[model samples]
Target: MPRFISKSLKKVGSSPGTLIHVGEIKTEQSSLSMLHFDAETHIEQPLTDIGEATSLLTPDATTWINVVGIQDIALIEDIGRHYHIHPLTLEDILNTTQRPKVESFDDYLFIVIKMLEHDKEKDSIVSEQLSLVLGKTVLISFQEDEGDVFNPVRERIRKGKGRIRSAGCDYLAYALIDAIVDNYFVILENVGQRLEAVEEAIDSDLDADILEKIHTIRRELIYLRKQVWPIREIITYLQKDGAPLIGEATGPFLRDVYDHTIQVIDTIESLRDMLSGMQDLYLSIISNRMNEVMKVLTIIATIFIPLSFIAGIYGMNFNHMPELTWRWGYPAVWLLIIGIVAMMIVFFRRKKWI
Candidate 1:
């Protein structure tokens, strides 16, 4: 589960206070990769030391320093020192569970987004926190792990395709956000398919396994919706809050990302509604099975009512009963009881109540 840290934790590098590890502690070390690029040329390098990354952050060309892991607090602090990032911002970066948000400062703009990817074999969704820092001619990103959904953007930058290379750092930020949002669609598709499979199985007999699968899908969707809803507000704030770091040219792109977020929210809401309906349907099916069981038991008791009455009458020892004295009377009474039971069975069959 992802913990939403309080804004008070935003205090920059303040005493390493109470490091609340929200999710998992990855085994990988925090590594830095620098991609310094311009319209005509590009350069990418892996940094062994944080100081080596600072010399590459020049105003002459746009730089994208991608941080792969974030467990090393010292490295993060050093990078913060180099860029003059606020302590609170550093805290947010170290805490990968932070919500999607955008903040503008005198020197740079900070944006946090959650990246979603679905693992088919595991049948689970993986979430990664991607934090982007935009300067005049550079963009820095920190990821919880290596290999993100930004490979497409990297390809675009490498191949010099489209306007990505021609644009500034803000445009790169838009591209990164857009890529993350697009991957949400992929995840939603998988979830929708799983829901559909569960629904089809539900149509026959309400299998316990099927219902459990449905429940699992519902839980995942709930988690996804929780993660995405606030992102809508984050994008809206970026578009309307008039952040200085977001360029006028990049505003429309960010607005486009806002639209994508809205689409994601709409899809999530639909999934939730579907899951609710599935729950109700499962309940009805289980109830119907229970009613059928009760009906069968009641019909068996009904069929035995007259038979029991016949047995009770013969069971009485009455001196005035002349039939009890007759030799064939006992056999005749047994035949009569059998005949009555046979008649009841036929009647139940005719009524379709058995």
Candidate 2:
């Protein structure tokens, strides 16, 4: 779980220093960076001073300021001041647990999305809130941590590989969102592979560990859905909203991003079904195992039932018991017991319940 810190929104002429934290706080500190690029040149730097970076915002070139951490209230205030961001917007930024949303203002657009990264070492998905403020000439991004999911986007911009450099802030925003969505594919693929492996293990035998693995994967998928579902709503809002901030040229591209979101949703639904099936399968396999155990116990019980009866009859010290005086009677009774056991074994074999 992550704790969203409270932000004081004094400058927006609303409540002064109101205490509100909207999101989960899984980590204590966040990282920050910036990427400024245009059609010709691109620059990336780790920003320490908000004022200096704010001064660097230019109308002629596109700027992307990436904030990895939002724990410091002062830093958030400084950034808000630099961009003339609304108090409510700043509050939302600090409140990292916001649902995915897109808000259009007179001068810019604010967007919140979840960035999901799967840690192979931990075998878990690390979800962090990614906030984007798309202005006319700059696109500022706030993240919960410093992760390399955007490396491909950075490289694409660096090499001028696509329409990224030529596009405006809206397109840049789309590119970043699209990149994150693409990473979801990677995550799904990994999960799918692990699921296949689990299926194989389950088919081989119902091991205790397999259930744990199935449950772990299922839990991760549930978390992934929590991170991804809201993003779809956010993108859909951006697409349908009649906002000047989102360019007309970016509509088709945003649609592409929406499709990816849908794909993610579909994959999640499928995984959920698979998880349910796996649980049922585990139950059935366990039941089958218990049945086998019970079958063996029942066979042993059946063989002993008659033997116990015969022994009880012989043990009864009665004057009318003539077999006690006959020496061959004991051997005959032993043979009878052996024959009963053999017949029961053959009957069990015929029923294929042995």
Candidate 3:
């Protein structure tokens, strides 16, 4: 089955705000981590129990709660209850197939986006749903798996490298989003390299495998576009809607992320166009090859037509046939056939048909 289609049959009859997990269980066990940081202080620790989330929340500092897995329904519900996150929002968090979007609530901003990575070994893109709940002093991030592209953001927060340490939870959220967007460029670069390789293969060798490669890349781009296109709107909403959870200072950064989204979308479109053109070029090349073969066969059959007719006329059983009694009949017929073939070859060459 195509990876783009999510199996949601389990949710067909379920009520809204149901916490049923809809996608693959990428992680075996769910884990939680809390990072509390301010300008001069930074504290990071893993939480063994959900009850510890309340004790770890520092009212004076910004808290980032990272949930590594979402398969645990009770854990998600506990977090939601503690943070006062909407049940619908929690449902979106558990359902990995949620579209990239941002919802503004009275207490928090619910944002869902796909974190994409290019798997080098598989030569394909792997996606995981990342849901962020940005509140006044705390930001909760829920992921389908443990690994993510947010390591650089974590490094910056830990090292106090930039204004992030001095910023609010909104800015921290922006930093995380920025990291995800920036990694998109890396993924695109990898895709561009793949496209270059495919193009070179198309030009140098018309292997049947090249078509499959083009289709694979094309499908990946389409899936990427679906995952990314809505992000533009999400950023636009964050920047322009002036959500209470999104600070005014973070607007420009969201705009920057919006620009990156545009670039990603444009690159996706350009690559898709290239794939379409390559597909057409491949089919045309195959058609021309087939035409060449048919032309050769047609010419051969044309050359043999007269020879077959001549031989057939002399092949009659009539004893009075003049050619059968002639001494040079077979040789004369051979010469005539050769002359006709040569003439046809010259004619075809003049017409540029061979």
Candidate 4:
């Protein structure tokens, strides 16, 4: 079963605003990490409780609180209560099957997007839902598990690279989203490589599993398209909705991310078209191979028809079969058989059918 469909089935009868964890339990326990930074100073620490998040927020410094696991409903509730997040937003955060979207609230903006990574060992794409809440001086990021593609963003924050250190929480939110969108390129690059391999296999060597490979890539593209297509609208909303949490300085950067999203979507569509073409090409190759085999079998059958007829006539124990009783009949029949076969071979060669 596809992960998207299977995870959504668990929420069939759920009421509105119900806090229920809907996806895979990626971590044993949810963990919190805070990065509070300004233009010159930075403080990074792990909190033992959600209550600590309030104390870490400062007027001068932008705080980024990262929750590594979302399976703990109580923890999510605590964070929601502390942050004044809406129950519907909290429900969306808990329900990992939520689509990529953005909701604007009075104090904060709720953004949900899928963070995708290529799992090399499994040779497949792994998706985790990421929910971001952007407030005045703080931004809280919720993830499904520990590992993420935000290490580069973290390193930038740690080293105080670019304008991120001097910027507001909106800029930080943009940075994190830009990181996710950038990682899409990396994942798409991996998918592109897989598509190339499949194409090469289809052209050079038609393995039995080539169709399965094409299908696997098609499914991955479908999954990726599902996750990525809505992000254009999400980014567009963030740019145009005039959410107070999103600053004017972040507009250009958001536009940049929007362009990148468009690029990613285009790449996905191109890969999908390539997969469809590859599928048709695979079918054509298989059909041509079958036709070749059938043609050879038909030719062989055609060649043997006369020989079988002669042998059938000779095998009949008719009282006076002239050819069967003649002394030279056996060798003559053998010569005739060979001559007919040679003539058929020459004819086939002249017709370019062999």
lDDT of 2: 0.81
Candidate order by decreasing lDDT: 4, 3, 2, 1
Worst 10 residues of 3 by lDDT: 50-59
Candidate 1: stretches off by over 4 Å: 1-22, 318-320, 327-335, 338-354
Please state every model's RMSD to the true fold in angstroms: 3.3, 3.8, 1.4, 1.7
Q: In every candidate, how many clashes are there?
A: 3, 10, 0, 0
Better of 2 and 3 by lDDT: 3
Question: lDDT tens string, model 4, 286-347?
Answer: 99999999999999999999999988888788998888679998999999999999999999
lDDT of 2 by residue, 146-180 (tens): 56478888889889998898787888889889988
Error of 4 at 49 (Å): 2.1
Best by TM-score: 3
Candidate 3 lDDT: 0.88
Which of the two, 2 or 4, has more lDDT?
A: 4
Could you estimate the TM-score for every candidate? 0.89, 0.89, 0.96, 0.95
Give the Cα-based TM-score of candidate 4 against the true structure. 0.95
**Where in model 2 is the C-alpha error above 4 Å?**
1-32
lDDT of each: 0.80, 0.81, 0.88, 0.90
- lDDT (Cα, tens digit) per residue for candidate 3, span 154-176: 99989999899887999999988
Model 3, runs deviating above 4 Å = none
